[model samples]
Target chain A: MDFFFEGYLLSHGNVIGFIAGTLTTISFLPQVYYVYRSKKTTDISLSMYLLFFFGVLTWLVYGLILGSPPIIFFNAITLLLSGAVLLAKLIY
Target chain B: MDFFFEGYLLSHGNVIGFIAGTLTTISFLPQVYYVYRSKKTTDISLSMYLLFFFGVLTWLVYGLILGSPPIIFFNAITLLLSGAVLLAKLIY
Candidate 1:
């Protein structure tokens, strides 16, 4: 039953989650681009991104433990986005 | 079994998820404060938060339908955070 449910979700939940996750992940791009273009991150908080990165990292681990690809994949992308924001905050 | 699992999770996952969720949610506060403090959202993207909000809203709905408290709770808080960011982008 567990295996069956996992397989079912892999085909359905994984696809749906990925689609939703991709949209959510790309949504941060504009902010990243804005900061990159402007070279100003004063209004952005460094701690926020730093903390967010860790939180997403934890979620990634959680997803992995649960064998949930969507959670893992989404968090990985989110980690990158948050990491970029943190880097921009530092550089700009 | 489902009820037991839900109850078990309500005591465990809910608490952990809420802790993680609160941390993630508050992480956005700093950004919000910075935006409010500077009143300069020139670097912030309205579309990012708008899209994020909808993505999270979808997640919230997904969680509710699945009867997953963690997803619903975290997304709810996230919705507020992202909403604030969008509002700040518009106002500032």
Candidate 2:
């Protein structure tokens, strides 16, 4: 879509930002999957996820205030993925 | 110092950003401490840290390009802390 390119694919900086965002965002998936399959979280730190969730949440709000789709999109995904890990840590 | 306030404490948004950055950056400390104390990393996902480290590195580069101190500062701390965890995961 034109909007996609304009939002995240236009400039080289934006492209680099997109890649950086994608790497960090998707990075959480393996952790989520790992915890889901193993159902073990003894080694995970509760405070880490707690702080991360809140931090990501704040970043989401920051994204909202800035009206940056990339920030909002990436942070939202990060929040969900990190939240999954946090939830797994709580449950298991 | 005037520079400190000007850099991170001037705008309300900047203050919020600083807090968010602090929360996420320091979040890794507990994990590092946990792994250090227990010397266990069975539950931690290797791919997650691998991706995260690179992602944070890219973010650091992005920060350098933007010449944003907050971005650079926060990401540098995150890189170190996450790297510590990744290192521990590799070792133990």
Candidate 3:
């Protein structure tokens, strides 16, 4: 019974993690779109995005080490999206 | 031997995760500083921060469910920082 309960909790935990990843990953979309449309990133911090880019990159490596496809996939998309924002901060 | 190697990899994975978490969490500092200093968030996306705020909040709850202090601690800080950004976006 205890094992069954643990498995149940673990499964739900994975579900929540999935949702959390999806939400946070896609959250960058609005910022990217806003920056692209406005062509303004003066208010955005270059250092923040730069650091975040590296952080996401590190997460990518972590995912590879863990052999977790979901982590790899989400972080990959996040890297691209955040990279776009970082580029906007640089160019615009 | 296999179990020992698995443990080693898992330990290293935890270390990497710690670093990744620290990096991503602190990355918000520059943006917060920039917004506070510039008093301009016109280019910062309201939707993005709004979504991110909730995402972090969910992570906090997820951490609690998982009974993981590191997850809770990091997400809590992220919640505060992202919340500040969201508030700034709304106010300025």
Candidate 4:
């Protein structure tokens, strides 16, 4: 019974973790698409995003050092997408 | 030798984790302040933050279940701040 309960918890944890990571990473897509379509970012707070971009970079490093796959993967994608938005804000 | 090395690694890990968690959570402040000042979210990506807000919610739950202070603390603050931004977006 204890073994079964442990297995259930582990599986549940993995599923929830995966979903949380995936949602957080992909959530940046709409902003990317919106900025792409609008060609304007006048209202976006540059400071907040610049800090967030760097924060994500640190997270990526932290994940690598800790050998956490979910953390690494999510931060990698988030960095790319957030980086793109930052670039778009810069360019147009 | 092993004990010294382990202590260094553990302390280093804690410091970096604290920095990362703190920066990520606090980085949202500027955006919050900006929105408060401008009363505008015309360029803010609603869908993106909406998903992100929920993702942070899931993260909070995951953190609680896993007994991770950094995750729980960061996400809790993030949710409140992000939630405020969302509410502001709705109100104004």
DockQ of each: 0.30, 0.45, 0.54, 0.56
In candidate 2, stretches whose alpha carbon ends up further than 4 angstroms from where it belongs are A1-11, B1-11
User: For candidate 2, lDDT tens digit of each residue in A1-92?
Assistant: 24545444334776788889999999999999999999999999999999999999988867765668998999999999999999999999
* Candidate 2 residue pairs in clash (backbone atoms < 3 Å): none
B1-92 in candidate 1: lDDT tens per residue?
A: 25546555444643444555667777888877788788887777788888888888777756754667777777888888878888988886
Residue B32 miss distance in model 3 (angstroms): 1.0
Give the worst 10-residue stretch by lDDT in candidate 4 chain A: A1-10
* TM-score of every candidate relative to the true structure: 0.78, 0.88, 0.86, 0.87
- Give TM-scores of the second chain, every candidate: 0.72, 0.87, 0.88, 0.85
Off by over 4 Å in 1: A1-16, B1-20
CAPRI-style docking class of model 1 based on DockQ: acceptable
Which digits, one per residue and each the tens of the lDDT, describe model 1 over residues A18-90? 5567778888888888888888887677888887877787676566555677777888888898788889988
The parts of candidate 3 lying over 4 Å away from their true place are A1-11, B1-11
Give interface RMSD for all predictions: 3.9, 2.7, 1.7, 1.6
Quote model 4's TM-score: 0.87
Query: Of models 1 and 3, which has the larger TM-score?
Result: 3
Give lDDT tens digits, candidate 2, residues B1-92: 24545434334766677778898899999999999999999999999999999999989878876778998999999999999999999999
Question: Candidate 1 or 4, higher TM-score?
Answer: 4
What candidate 4 gets wrong by more than 4 Å, as runs, is: A1-11, B1-11
Per-residue lDDT tens digits of candidate 4, residues B1-92?
25646556555776766777777788789889989899998888888888989999989878866878889999999999888777777777
Clashes of 1: 0
